[model samples]
Target: MTTTAAAHTDLDGTLPPLAEPWDPAEFETRLRAVGEERYHDRHPFNVRMHSGDLSPSELRRWIGNRFHYQRHIPVKDALITAKLDTPALRRMWLRRIQDHDGPAEGEGGIERWLRLGEAAGLERQAMLRGDTVLPGVRLAVDGYVNFCRLRSPLEAVAASLTELSAPDLMRARIEAFERHYPWIGTEGLAYFRSRVSQGRRDSREALDLVLAWARTRDDQERAVAALRFKCDVLWSLLDAVDAAGHREPA
Candidate 1:
């Protein structure tokens, strides 16, 4: 049968049900597994980035395109916060927004990313407008924001668990930028540096929330699927960047 038919059969109970609920440790293992196999850190663009293969223009293009994603971080976090029913959960989730958007002007991850764009030779105003960002990048980012807005709160929180693997990638990226892209300026690395610690903290909180909430087999499966969907989102963004081709010389 075709894949769609198989899915319909499974939904109709023609196929056996999924296995029982995993222990918390097992569930955590499964969630991390999604990142292991699918995280964008393994994407070709990142591979070339770490290996010092991307040209200055290629690097600038990535910075510009990725800024589109960066700018949306707080927006997605706000959606997740809005889905939360408890004050405690909302309070905890609100920090993500603060981290990305900050309390004042000229602060936060969004601002730091724009600094990186400037360091990469992109005009600050143009990067802010995002007019030159690749179409695929915009679509991928919008899809992720919509996922958080539409999915269950539990699934949305689980999706943000991609932060679990982000610290390692951020650290490696800082090293790569410092060693290979020395001309980009030290200030530009601040975004990656800030994320290393923030990613770990955010992932821990998200994992705890997922572990507490995903109590049933179906819930566990959905949480895992949410994480996988997020991995695909990141991977698709990179795929789009790769397809758009590295920036050509002026």
Candidate 2:
């Protein structure tokens, strides 16, 4: 099944069409299947955290470690935004940062995450400074920013498709936090809970943007690859955090 724009020309000037293309239903399936196979919900750490299987210390490590990724949201969006030459593109991408960082200091996802940290017993200063971030997590997120800056806008947006799979993970995080970490009050987990609602709206809009703009077969392939790249970025971050929990005493 190929969509109207699903043909491609190769280096040798041979033409090929994608095995599957943008039939509306097929497109939706492909886009969503990417999330089903690769989303963080499938990651072991996420599984453990949400299943009430992690210890308090493990939960704390996750919160502290993920603060690094949460902080990088604005930075990555800025990098992606820098590559956009059009106000339209800028307008759409900028909202991602706004959604996370909020309109002012006391608002948005980052500050909410801080409240979460404070509730978890981690120091605000340490989290704000990113002093406790794992080295691997930093490397992975930096790579995502670099990919967005260097790749085409379609690809950059595709990389953001992990957000498509994020709402489910957010729900699981909230459920787990509420059930297992009662010591951490609603104020602390409020950030994570808020994100479930926001991530759904944001990711849906972003996915539509990518799908609508990715008209050609080559474009779709690149878009899919970019999404896979993003999944690795997310998966690696979790892997780093989970691995840290297993490190032995020196």
Candidate 3:
């Protein structure tokens, strides 16, 4: 997939001269437009996987490498949550942390992803150690987390609007796994299944907050850029994964 400038470059606090803030509906349409144009759903790696063209080596490598991104979700959410003002806002946002981390051990999305690792022929311990994670994947995911950490609370939350497009991707992934990679047990798909619903709920909540908080054209533009940056993050992560065996040694 072709990456936009938003993916590789910093925002640098630039925007055109302020105009009227877009109506909520149009602003949302614009956000969805970014996803439609640049979401990782169309990346060749993903396209190959969905079409049953991925080798077991590639699939296993991806399961492990992608776990690096999954594990940091809460850390990113926590940073954003801290930046949110008011107990009510923090309380609402904290559910994201709980959803990923869960209320106890041996649960949550990370735990489910580890089970997915097991299903894909990776050992739990090794996956936890990020044994198959490539340098580029790490850099990409870390850049995402840092974008959340350093940006405004609103922009950080805007980056999460990727969840807006996530449910369908999760469904496609589940279908792809079942159809193209049947050697993997059905149980491993729980993580993807879980995300289908989680994605909808998260995106709705996030969209409401984003629309409400971004009260100016400048704020809206920055928010859109943040979402674009996130799409690039995912695209870049896949770019790294697709390069698995071809990269030069550090």
Question: Which numbered prediction scores highest in TM-score against the true structure?
Answer: 1
TM-score of 2: 0.88
Find the 10 residues in a row with the least total lDDT in model 3: 9-18
**Each candidate's TM vs. the true structure?**
0.91, 0.88, 0.91
RMSD of every prediction: 3.5, 4.9, 6.8
Worst 10 residues of 2 by lDDT: 2-11
Cα lDDT tens digits, model 3, 1-250, are 9976556544774443447999999999999999999999999999999999988888988899999999999999999988988999899889999988988999899999999989988899999888779999999999999999999988999999999999999999999999989999999999999999999999999999999999999999999999999999999999999987455354
- Supply the TM-score for candidate 1: 0.91
lDDT of 2 by residue, 52-169 (tens): 8888777777788888888888888888788778998799879888978899879998898888888988899988788778899889888887887788878887888887777777
TM-score of 3: 0.91
- Would you list the C-alpha lDDT of every candidate in the order shown? 0.90, 0.82, 0.92
> Which ranges of candidate 2 are over 4 A from the true structure?
1-21
**Candidate 3 CA-lDDT value:** 0.92
